[model samples]
Target: MAHTIQGKKQLLTRVRRIKGQAEGLERALNAETECLAILQQIAAIRGAVNGLMAEVLEGHIRTHLGAHDISETQRDNDMEAVVAALRSYLK
Candidate 1:
């Protein structure tokens, strides 16, 4: 992700936070927290993951395709792939 080096620190920070969140979830599981609370944690984790994905996707577009080296067809295909990914992820 040399092209994304500028955002690397921010991305790593987000990942570290996610790791902490995951550890907390594990602790909650070990402590047998309420089912509702566990579900909420899971939802929060999912949202964090989705947010990370969006940032990476944004970087990919701006760094790779933005260089204008690829053909229009290739660019369109890449965008379609991004859309497909989002669709599956949201489902």
Candidate 2:
């Protein structure tokens, strides 16, 4: 999407951070870290992922659905796409 392209760097940084968190979680698992610590790490990773998703989703909404210049058909299509994506993500 255009918005994603515009924010590509920021999104990539988030993805890299998430990757680092995943690697840390792996290391913790291998090292047999305490259960509470592991849980906290997992929660942190999940929160990071959710934040990334929210950012992208917001961009999509603003760029596609919220644009006043777009045609009605285009807006409907974008809305459907967003709904489908949200449904899949929720599942």
Candidate 3:
């Protein structure tokens, strides 16, 4: 995908925050945090990551699937990829 300034900025911010959250989780583990607290943090990180994935998939649908230039086959492939990702993520 071609990089637009806005897309790049948004993705970079999301990825950086996810990285920070992952590091915080590691620190919590290393510090022997309470099981409940650690699990809560892990769950929060997972939600954040999933939300980011959804946002990217939405953009893919709009930019690629909705584009007039793309063929029907390509659009179907994109939708299939999104559905496969959603199923995997939901599992």
Candidate 4:
């Protein structure tokens, strides 16, 4: 998609950060870290993942829905609303 064309590096950096978070969780598990701390790390990883999902969803709305110039601004506005709702829901 156009996202990869323009946002490849951006997306890759996010994914790599997520990978690091996952590895941190694994290390915590292996090292017998406290359960509470481990859960916090998992929560952080989940947040990062949710953030990535939002970015992809936004891109999809812009790329596909925005393509039909009819109501492009409305679609953009709707996408923003959806993103805000998602953040609230995810939280």
- Give all candidates' CA lDDT scores: 0.86, 0.97, 0.84, 0.85
Which runs in model 4 stand beyond 4 Å of their true positions? 69-91
**Between the candidate structures 1 and 4, which one is better when assessed by TM-score?**
1
Cα-based lDDT at residue 43, candidate 4: 98
Write the residue-wise lDDT of candidate 4 on 3-74 in tens digits: 656888888899999999999999999999999999999999999988888888788777766677648677
Error of 4 at 45 (Å): 0.5
Q: Score candidate 2 by TM-score against the native.
A: 0.94
lDDT of 2: 0.97
RMSD of each: 2.3, 0.9, 2.0, 4.8
lDDT for each residue of candidate 2 in 1-91, tens digit (9 for 90 to 100): 8999999999999999999999999999999999999999999999999999999999999988999999999999989999999999889
Given candidate 2, what's the lDDT at residue 26?
98
TM-score of every model versus the real structure: 0.76, 0.94, 0.82, 0.73
Candidate 2 — which pairs collide?
none
Least well predicted 10-residue stretch by lDDT in candidate 2: 82-91
Model 4 clash pairs? none
Error of 4 at 66 (Å): 1.4
Residue 69's lDDT in candidate 1: 85
> What stretches of model 1 exceed 4 Å from their correct place?
71-91
Superposition TM-score, candidate 4 onto the true structure: 0.73
lDDT of 1 by residue, 8-40 (tens): 888999899899889999999999999999999
